[model samples]
Target: MTSPTVSVKRVSECFVKPQHDHSQDAKQPIYLTPFDLPFLNLNYSQKGLLFAKPPPSENQHFSITTFLNNLRNSLSATLTHFYPLAARLATRKQQNPPSYVIYIDPENSPGVKFIHATVDVSVSDILTSTYVPSVVHSFFDLNGAICHDGHTLPLLSIQVTELTDGIFIGGSVNHVLADGTSFWLFMSSWSQIFKSNVNENACFVSRTPIFKRWVLEQHDPITSLPFSYPDEFIERYERPQHLKERFFHFTTASVSKLKTKANTECNTEKISSLQAVSALLWRCVTRARHQPLNSETICKLVVSNRGRANPPMSEDYFGNPIGSVSATTTVEELMAHGLGCAALRIHEAVRSHDDKAVKTQVARWYRNPVVYKMSGLLPPNITHIGSSPRFDMYGCEFGLGKAVAARSGMMNKGDGKVTMYPGREGGGSMDVEVCLLPEYMMDLECDEEFISALIEE
Candidate 1:
C-alpha cells in the first residue's frame, strides 16, 4: 500500500539582501579556486533542520509572522559577513573558453530567495521514520538548478516548511560558493544571530566569515575552468535502479566497538571512527548487491584539503577546500576479508593523501579538468561518501530550540551516495544516511550478519 500523500503550499515569498551595502566589489570577479570550479555544474547542496513547534499555551504571543520576521532580519545581518553568498555567478563570454565567475552587484543583483511554506504532515511523521518520506524533498527549492545555473538562480535559497506540530528549515546553497563546512558554518552563525535577537540581553557576538582566498597562490582572482562546458551533459542521468534511503544511527558506544574491532584486525595502525563506519557501510552494501566475487568495488571518501595545504590553512577558511581519495578492492576480497581488512585499505588510502599528495591532485586538476556529473563519477554500486559526522549540525540553535532531526534534500542524491551527520545526542555518536537500490536496502535491513553489530537502528 502507498504511504499517505504529503503536500505543501507556499504561504509567502521575499528576497532578503545583506543589511550592509557591498557595491564596491560589484563588477570585481570573486575568485573561484580550482577546488571550487568543479562544483560549477553540480546542483546546490541541500539540507534541512526540523524543530518542534512550541505549544500555544507556552507562548500565546508566538506567531509565524513574527518568527519569520526575526529570521529574515537575522539572515540579512548574517549576509553582511558572508557577502559572497548573496552574489550570483556571471559568465565571461569574451574568453576563448567561456568561464563563470561570482559577481555581486547588490544594487541590481537579486538577494537570497526566501519562501515560507506549510506541509500537511505532523512532526511525528518526519522524526519517527527510519526511512524518510520522499515527499520531504519538496521542503526545499532549486530542486534541479545546478551551480552553473547560479548565473541567474539565487546563489542561496531558503524554504521554511511549517508542519502541523513542527518547522522544517531547508536551504539550497550553490556548491561553487561553499562546501559542507562552509554551509554548516553559515547555518550555525544564522542561528546564533536569531537567538541573540530573541533575547536582547544575550551576548550577540557576530561570527566572521574567513574569506581568505589568497591561500591558493596558484589560483587567479579571475577564475575559469580548465575545460569548457556544453559537452557531455552536466546534469546527472541516474540509474534505473529503484532507489531507497535509510538513516543508520550508530551510538557512541557502538562506534567505539566498531573502532576497537577494526583496530584489532588491522592492528598495524589505529583506524579512525570515520574509517570504521565507512568500512561497515561499504562491506554491507556490497554484500547486499550480491555481485560476483570477482567484481571490483570502490569507495570514494570525500575529505577536506584545508589541513593538507602548505602551512596548513585555517580550519575556518571559507570556500571549497575539499579533495577525495578512492579505495578499491574486489568484491570477493572485500566480502571474504571482513570489515577490518576493508577498513585497513581505506585507512591506508587516507593516510597516503598527505600535504604533498593533495597539492599534486590540485596541480593535476589545473592541467586537466573535467566538469563532473554526479551520476557518472563512480561505477555502479560503488560507495561515494560525502559530508561528515564532525560538522556541528546540532549546535545550530535558532531560538526555536535544538533541531529534532537533520536531513538532506534531493540534491546530489543517487544510489551509493552517503552523507554522515552528528547524531542529535552528540557525544561521538554518528548518523550514517544511506541511499541505495530498493532491493539492496531491503537486503541490507535484513542482513543479520551486518546488522548483528552494535547499531542503534
Candidate 2:
C-alpha cells in the first residue's frame, strides 16, 4: 500500500513560563535516581499520535484553526504545573564538585517545539490498514543525535497534524526526563486543559507534578557521576537493520479464555490478564525465533513504582519511577510446559515487586554508582517488555472526543521488544504492538496456536 503524504506547514518554538516563581530553588540539582542514569547517555524519545474525529460544525468555536490555537495555549498553561518539563538538563562543571541538575533558566532554554502540519489522508485510511503506516513518523520530531556528554535537548516537542477528516496530536518527549507513565501524565493534563477550555482563568491542570528534588536526594546525594556507553550497547543500537511494526489485537473474550487455560494448567493460581497475555506472547516469540532448546531466555517486565513506594509516592511524582523484573527459563522448559508455566513465572516476577524491593534496589545502585549493563547479557534471548495495558491511552479527549487511535514511535522493531496498549474497541481488549526481525515475525504469523488465540472477527 502507498503511504500517505504529510507536508509541514509551519515550524515554530513555544516557550511557556511557569505561573508561579520557582527561581529561588531552580538552580538546585534534581538528583538522578539509579533508574535515571542508564538513560543519561541515551537519546531515547517516545512519540504518540492521538486521532480525534472531525468537529460537528464549521463555526469559529469548532474550526481547525481555533482547535490548534486552543491546544497551543493550553499546552503553554499546562507547562506551568509541569515546570521541569519546560526546563533543561545540565551539569555544573565549575563547581568544586560538579552537580547534575535540571536548569529552569527561562531566559535561556527554548521551551518545547510545536509543529503545524497537514496530511493528505483520512484517519480511516491509516487506521483501517493492516499495518501501521510509515508516514506516522512524520508526526514527530525525534532526536537524531546520540548524547555522550549528557548534553541538553528540548525535553518535549508537539506536532499537530490536520487530517482530511480529523486531527492528529503527536508528542515527542525525551525518555531521560520521564518514562511512559510520566509522559502520559503530561499528555493527559494537556487534554484536560483543552477540555476545560483554554480561557485565561482555566489555567490550572488537574494533576500537579511533584518536582521536589529532596525525595530522591535524601536517599542518594547528588554528586559528579561518570557516564559510560559500553561498546556492545553502542553496536547493538547502531546496527543497520530493517524492521517491521505490526499491531495484533486481542479481544476481552479471547483474553479471558487464555487466562482460564493458563490458570487451569497452573492449578488455578489466579494469574492476571497481563501475566497470561505476556506469557502467551513470550511463548509465541520464543518458538518463532527457533532458538536452541537448552538456551536460556528471559522476559524483562518494566514495573512502575507509583504505588510500590513506601507509603506510596504521589500519583503525579513524575520522573522515571520504574524498575524491571525478569522471568527467566530455558527454551526447552518453556516449550515443554506451555502457557501455564510461563504465566506462573511471570506472575511470580511481578508479585516480587514491592516497597522494600524498590528501596533496596535504589540503595544498591546508590552504593555502586555504576549503571547496570543490559547489553550482551543474554544476547538475542532477551525480550524487554515496556509500557502497560492499564494506561488510559484512549481516554485522552481534547474537547472533540476520545481518541480513535494511538500509536507510539519509540517502540522500535528490534529483535525482541514489545509494547502493550489498551485496545480502542474499549471492552477491556489489548493492542499488542510486536517488533521483531522479518523472518521471526513471519514465523509468529504462521503459528497455529498464536493464530487460534486471536479474535478473528
Candidate 3:
C-alpha cells in the first residue's frame, strides 16, 4: 500500500483576534494570572521537529488553506461539544508566547514518516490476532503524547483527522503549554473551529489576565515555609536519564476482583476499586524493583478533581483542577498485615491532600515560584490513577471513525511510573498502562503469578 502523505502550510491570514466577553466590569478582576487562565495555555518552548508519512494516494497532497480551514472548523466543533473553555484560551495571550500550529510537508518520505503521523494500537487478541487495531491505545497516545520541535514552526501540534470525527486523529502537543486536560480542550476546540461549529460562549473565555507574581502578592499568610527537598532527591531530579520507568496495565474487572477478594479475606467494609488496585500496584512495583520499602516509601497518585471538588470548577475551567497528592507505601509490614489495612493507608494518603491543601499549594507556588519550580524539577514517584482519558471520550466525533491506537509518552518521571485510565469500548472496566525501566520489567516478568495478575480475565 502507498504511504499517506501529510503536508501542512501556514495560511498567512490565519491570525484572528481572540473572542472575549466585555460585559464584566473593566476593573481588574482578581488580578489576572496563569492560574486564572486555563492550564492548557501555551508557553514559549525549545525548538523541535515533526514529520508525517506520505499519503497513500499518488495525488492526495492536502492544501494549506484547505487544511487550515478544516482544522479551524474541527477545533470549533470539538470545543462546542466537549469543552467550551477553548474560545477563552484563543483570546487569552500574554507576552504572546510564540506558539503557533504549522503545516508539515510529508511529501515523499521514509516509511517511518507515516508511522510518526499514525496512531498506535492495543496488543490484544481483538487487535493482534484479528489484524485489527483497537482504538483504545490511539486515544491514550493522542491525549498523553508530546512533541519535540527544532524548526521555524517551533510549536507542538495535535492534529485531529477531521472537523467532525475527533477520533482516528493524531498530533503532538507541547507539555509546557498546558496540563493534560487543558491541552485536550485546546485540541478539541481547534478541531471544532476547523469544522466551523465554534460555540459562542465557550469556557476558554479569558478572565482578567493575572501574572503568577501578582497572585502571590494578593494572599495573606503568604509566607509559608518552602517545601523542603531532600538532598538525594535534588540530585535525582537533575539527572533525568537516571530515573527508571515502566508501563503495566490492569482491567477494571481485575481490580474489582482483587478488591472483592481482599475485602472478603479481611472481613471488612468494601474497599474502593481504586484503593484495592493501588495497593496491588504499589506492592507489585516495589517487589519488581527488589527493594525493601517502608511506610516512608511513598507512591504519589494524581487524581483529577473535575467532578469531586466542593465548588467544582466548570468543565470549561481548562486549568489544573484544585487537588493534591494521594500517597501510600509498599512496605512489607503494610502489605503483610492485610489488604484492608493497606487500603486504609492509601485512602488516607489521598484524603490527606484534599482540595484545601491543593488550593494552598497552588497559592504558595504563585507567592514562591521558586518552591514550585524546585518541586517540579524533582517530582515524587507519581502513579496517576483514573486520569487517563483514553477510553472516556474515545467516541470523539472530529469527523473521523474511531482511532486505531492511543498511548501517552510525555510522563517521563519517577522510579515506577503508571497511569490508570478507562479501557477501550468503555469495556465495562479500566486499564492501567505502566512505563518503567527495562530492568524492572525483567524483574516483574520473572514472577509469572505477578505478571498474570495484570492480564484481564
Predicted structure with the largest lDDT when compared to the true one: 1
List TM-score per model, in order: 0.93, 0.88, 0.59
* Candidate 2 residue-wise lDDT, 1-457, digit = tens: 4365555454444545544445656545565656676554454555575665555564334676677777878887887777666666664443434333332333344577677777777787767876677676676765343322224556777878777777778777766568888888888888888788766688777788776532443653553354322342332243214566788988999888889889999897579988988999999999999999999989878888878887787778777778889999999999999799999999999888888888888777766665333344325887778788787777688876778777876423367878888888777788898877789889999998789989543
**Runs in model 1 lying further than 4 Å from the true structure:** 1-4, 23-27, 95-108, 198-206, 214-221, 226-233, 236-241, 455-457
User: Candidate 1 residues 1-457, lDDT tens each?
Assistant: 1155767899999998877676565434566677787776688899889998887787676788889999998888787777777778765433555543443333445789999999778888876777878768889999878887887889899999988888999999998788899899899888888877833344243556677573345565555553344443367444344568788888998888888888898775579989998999899888888988988998999999888777787777778888889899899899888778989999989989888898787777767765677667656759999999999998887878788989998778777888999989988898888888788889999987568765554
> Candidate 3, residue 208: CA error in Å?
17
Candidate achieving the largest TM-score: 1
Model 3 per-residue lDDT at 353: 65
lDDT ranking, best first: 1, 2, 3
For model 2, state the Cα shift of residue 331 in Å. Answer: 0.6
Better of 1 and 2 by TM-score: 1
> Among all windows of ten consecutive residues in candidate 2, which has the lowest summed lDDT?
227-236
Local accuracy by lDDT, each model: 0.80, 0.71, 0.41
lDDT for 91 (candidate 3): 22
Model 1, global lDDT: 0.80
